[model samples]
Target: MKTSRLVIGILSIVLAVIVLFQSCAVGIGNALQANEEVSGSAGLMVAVILLVAGIIGIVTRNGGKGPFVAGAFYALGGILGLTNAGSYGDLILWSVVCFLFAAVFIIGNLIKKKS
Candidate 1:
């Protein structure tokens, strides 16, 4: 359990970085071209949420309510990203990953409790 959290934490942080970089690159491209095919700000916000979720995951390595908390953040970020993804295929991928992580964290905790 602790190991899972650690792994997810590191993974999420890496995802956050990827999202941030992509968001910035897209935003710059849109700015240069004067277009709005995809909302860069929305992507940036989702990245921030994922980053926080990752941090929470890392801090919750003690195995308390950390998974639930991090899961909430992940879900929130995922939903937001999905809603605003527009033409950004990468955003959808990121959102899906975050949502899946959220489910894993939350469900893992519940299963542990039941066992």
Candidate 2:
């Protein structure tokens, strides 16, 4: 898998987690806040495309690393959405989530390569 793709895969997982958490928040205000964060249809479309790409990477690649790389691209697209269409406050939170997954992908790839 390519390095850029790996980074994106990690980001995808992170963004997904952030969205899930915000959506599940107990407060109505938080939920409403999440609603407002939605960007335009273009951003949404990008996220969907990234997701599809990630899935393809996972399924088509020979090694486990391929999926992670693809997933990073997916996350990068989500970050674009959260930063562009999503709320500023939510962007940081979401980016952090993306970062974490990116780290995982990086580590996983390194480990996989080492073996």
Candidate 3:
């Protein structure tokens, strides 16, 4: 269980980085093109939040709550992206990936608690 938490913590941090980079890329591209703001800022904010949560989870792996909290944030971000599909478009794919990762962590945490 400890090992699994460590692995999940690392992966969550990696995913957070990916999401943050992707959000920044999109925001920069929009700014360079002089396009009106869209969902980029929201996505960026969510990514930043996720990144922070991931770091916290990594730091508090033994606490058992960090991963679950981070996973909930991931799931919330994914759902937000999905619900705002008109603005997010292709980003929804990334959201789906987030959902999958969230499910893994949340379920793992739950099962660990049960055992």
Candidate 4:
């Protein structure tokens, strides 16, 4: 398991948690307010998906191709986020970070394989 992959996995999980908490907060706030708009479900779904992917990456990190699989999931989530930009502009940043992490995992793995 490469250190970079491990670090990326941990960061991804952390980011997922942050997104989840924000989603929950928004949901609760909306529920408490009669006129409040509901706008957290999308964020929640994205966070959950990312969380699952991060966990998968961590669990399979020793399997050689696990990081790549995880990276793909992250990239996909990021792309999906683009469609929900109206409610969450942070999605762009999240997507960029995810892509960068994926790139690191892929390039690192390729180098390791070649060596």
Between candidates 1 and 4, name the one with more favorable lDDT: 1
- CA shift of 89, model 1, Å: 1.6
lDDT of 3 by residue, 1-115 (tens): 5566567667766766776777777778778877675567756766775666566656766756777787787788787767654444656876786687678668877887888
Model 4: runs farther than 4 Å from truth?
Answer: 25-39
Model 2 over residues 40-110: C-alpha lDDT tens digits?
Answer: 33244444544555455545345565655654664675566455644435545544544554555556566
Q: Any idea how many clashes model 4 has?
A: 0
The best candidate by TM-score is 1
Scored by lDDT, the top model is: 1
Count clashing residue pairs per candidate. Answer: 0, 14, 0, 0
Q: In candidate 1, which residue pairs get closer than 3 Å at backbone N, Cα or C atoms, i.e. clash?
A: none
TM-score of 2: 0.44
- For model 1 the local lDDT of residue 101 reads 89
User: Model 3 reaches what TM-score against the true structure?
Assistant: 0.71
TM-score of every prediction relative to native: 0.91, 0.44, 0.71, 0.75
Deviation in angstroms for 41 in model 4?
3.3
Q: How good is model 4 by TM-score?
A: 0.75
lDDT measured at residue 93 in model 1 versus the true structure, 0 to 100: 88
Give the winner by lDDT: 1 or 3: 1
